[model samples]
Target: MQTLVLVAHPHLADSTTQQFFKASLPSTGVTYRALTAQETYDAAREQAALRQADRIIFQFPLYWYAAPASLAQWEAAVLTRTFVYGDHRYPLADKELGVVVTTGMPAQAFRRGGTENVTIDALMAPLAALAHRAHMTWLPTLAVHQFNYLDEAQKLQLVVDYQRYLTQPAPDTLANRQAWFADRLPAMVAQLAPADRATGELIVTTMTQQQDDLEALMATLAMIKEQDDD
Candidate 1:
C-alpha cells in the first residue's frame, strides 16, 4: 500500500529512537514528510499527499502527553471541513490511519496502576478519535517506550518488528503471524550450519504444529459456545 508518514518530532535529528525507527522504514511505497518548527505549513501540498496515500501515519515523540505543536498546527491548517468532510464526501474515507509514538518512560509504566497511570491506548485516544471523525480505519498504534535503554540486540529486534508493522500486507491476526514465521523460518534456518539447520527446522516444525493444535482447540471451543447459545 502507498503509505505517507507525517513525522512531527520537533527534534528528530537528536532523537536516537526516531532516527533509528525512521531509518528502518521500507525504501519503497512510503513517503516521509518531516514537520519542522521553522517551516511554513503547506495545507494544499499536505492534502494532496494524503489523497495519494492508502495509509496515513502520524509519527512523533510524545511531548507533554501529546504530539508536538507543529503537528497540531498541521492538523488545524490541513484538516479543514471542506477538505476532510465536504458535502461531496470525506476525502480520507476508507483509508487507514496509524500512529507511531516514542516515549521516554518504560512501556510497563504506561498501564493501569503504573507510574503513568494510563494505558498507551488511553493516551492515544485523541488520534483514534481523529481517525473516527475522518472516516478512516484506525490501525493499532506502534508505541516505542524507553528506547534509550535498549541494548543493541533488543534495538535490532525492535527495528525489525517496526519494519514489519509498517510493511505487513495483512492485518494483525494469528493466522498472518503464523504465516510470517513460516515464511521467514527457511531463510533464517539457511544461515545456520548443517548440524544446526536440523535443530532450527525441528523448532519451526514444532512451533507450527503447536499453532495448528491451538487453532483447532479454539475452533472446538467456539463450536461449543455456539451450541450453548443456541
Candidate 2:
C-alpha cells in the first residue's frame, strides 16, 4: 500500500530538524509530497494524493496545541461531505491514518496538570472525530518532544529513526506491540544511526480504538483470572 506523508511545518527552510528529515527520505516505492512551499493551498492536489494513498500519515509539529494551520486549512477546504463524510464515496473511509508530531516541550507538559495544561488525547480530539466519521483506522500517534534541545548529530539520527518508525508495520495488539518493542529495543538502541535518533525518542501516544480494545481485553483476562482463583 502506498503511504502518503503530508507535512505541515510553516517554516521548513529555517527548521534544521524537519528539513533534514524531509531531505533524507528514500523514494524506493513510497510516494512523498511536501507542501511547505508558499503556494495557494490546492485542494485538488491534496485530495488526489489522499485518494492514491492506502495509508496516510500526517507529519507535523504541534502548533498552538493543534496541527499546523495549513493542515487545518486543507481539512476545512478539501474534506467535504460527499468526498469524506456523507456518501459512500468518502475516499478515506477504509484507509489507515496515522499522526506524527514533533514538539518542543516534554511529555509531562501535555498531561492533566502539566505545563502545557491539556493532555495529548484531549488536544487531539478533532482528529479522532475525523477518523470516526471517515471510518479510517487510527494508528497510535508518534510524538517527538524537545526537538530544539538535540544537537546536530542527534537531529540527524532523529530523522533516520523517525523514518523507520513511520514505516514500521502496525502491531496487531498492545500486548504484541509491547513484546515487539522489548525484543527490538536493544538492537534499535545500539545501532541507532546519526539521523534517526530524534524520532527514536518519540512517545507513541494513544489510538482510541486500540485503547478501547485493550480495555476490553484486560477486563476479559481479569475475569478469567478470577475464575482461576475461585
Instruction: Give each model's whole-structure lDDT.
Output: 0.85, 0.73
lDDT of 2 at 153: 93
The superposed Cα distance between candidate 2 and the true structure at residue 137, in angstroms, equals 0.8
Model 1, runs deviating above 4 Å: 178-230
Clash total of candidate 1? 0
Q: What are the clashing pairs of model 1?
A: none
Encode model 1's per-residue lDDT on 16-120: one tens digit a residue: 877887788876788988988777767898899999999998999899889899888889888888988789689899999988898899988998899989988
- TM-score of each candidate? 0.79, 0.68
Error of 1 at 31 (Å): 1.1
Per-residue accuracy of model 2 over 1-230 as CA lDDT, tens digit each: 57888887888778866776677664443566555534566677778888888778887888888998878776777787777866466678778888878888998899878998888778778888899889888887878788778888977777655655455456455565454454455556556786876555442223333556877888899899999994
What total of clashing residue pairs does each candidate reach?
A: 0, 12
Candidate with the greatest lDDT versus the true structure: 1
